[model samples]
Target: MDLVTFQNTILPIKDKLFRFALRIVGNPMEAEDVVQEVFIKMWNNRYNMAEIKNHEAWCMSVTRNLSIDKVRSKFRRETGIPEGTDWRDEGLSPHKSAELTDAVSRVRQLMETLPESQRRVMELRDIEEMSYQEIADLLELTMEQVKVYLHRARKTIRQQLIQSESYGLQ
Candidate 1:
């Protein structure tokens, strides 16, 4: 593809790529770097891109691999909610907003406690809203395996939420 074609076809997926990278790397700045690297890789391989089907999934796989590589290079990483985000809900009362934030935080914490596969599967399936086949393709898992992981992840989170609710949302 030429420059304009590349920009039109490729540039739109940048945000999704960034979000996937951020999900893995857990740092916005690092995610940005990963995205830049992905773009560079895509540009370099632009001629070959047409041979591959499903560019979005291809991009997501690349992002996932690069982010995992980045994490491996670093010593340790603990993250959630990509710090410094302010996603305000204009309709919510302040108290309701606080509750929503806390609930989200709690769910994130619960996700952190899950195994890596389970957490990643949950994020891809629920958060990103990818189809099972797409997830299986990207994660290189069987469809049944993807379903099992997602089901377990949701079951665990649901149970945790129920437990927390019983305890009155401390």
Candidate 2:
């Protein structure tokens, strides 16, 4: 595809891809590298892109694969720990901001505890707002599997959040 077409089609989804990569790789710098690599791959193979339907799904699939590959290559035995959360918000009181930050951090911790598949499914469905069919196509899982993982992930996070609230996890 031409630069204009590429810009119109591919550029819009870069943030989504970067977020997915960050969720998997857990480092902002590494995530940026992953997105750049994805862009390079896409640009290099632009001629063949037309043969693939659903560019977003295809890009997501590539981003997931690449992120996983990066994690595995760099840390075979280490699980990724998410970093670089922006804990700033305007207009909130300090107490409120700290409370919100703590809650978000707790949820991020809960997400980290999930099984990789469940976490990925949750991020794709909830964070990226992808459809079940699209997630299935990208992850090469059945629709049922994606739904089950997402359900389990959400349930686990919700239950954990409730339990933490009960215990006062601040």
Best by TM-score: 1
Once fitted onto the true fold, the runs of candidate 1 whose alpha carbons sit more than 4 angstroms away are 76-100
TM-score of each: 0.83, 0.82
Residue 7 CA error for candidate 2 (Å)? 0.7
- How many clashes would you count in candidate 1? 0
Candidate 1 Cα deviation (angstroms), residue 165: 0.9
Predicted candidate 1 versus true structure: per-residue lDDT over 1-170, tens digit per residue: 78998799888989889878877777777889999999899889989988988788878888999999998876455444456564334335888877776767777779989999988898887878989999899999999999999999999989999999999984
TM-score of candidate 2 versus the correct structure, residues matched by position? 0.82
lDDT of each: 0.84, 0.84
After best superposition, candidate 1 residue 114: deviation in angstroms?
1.3
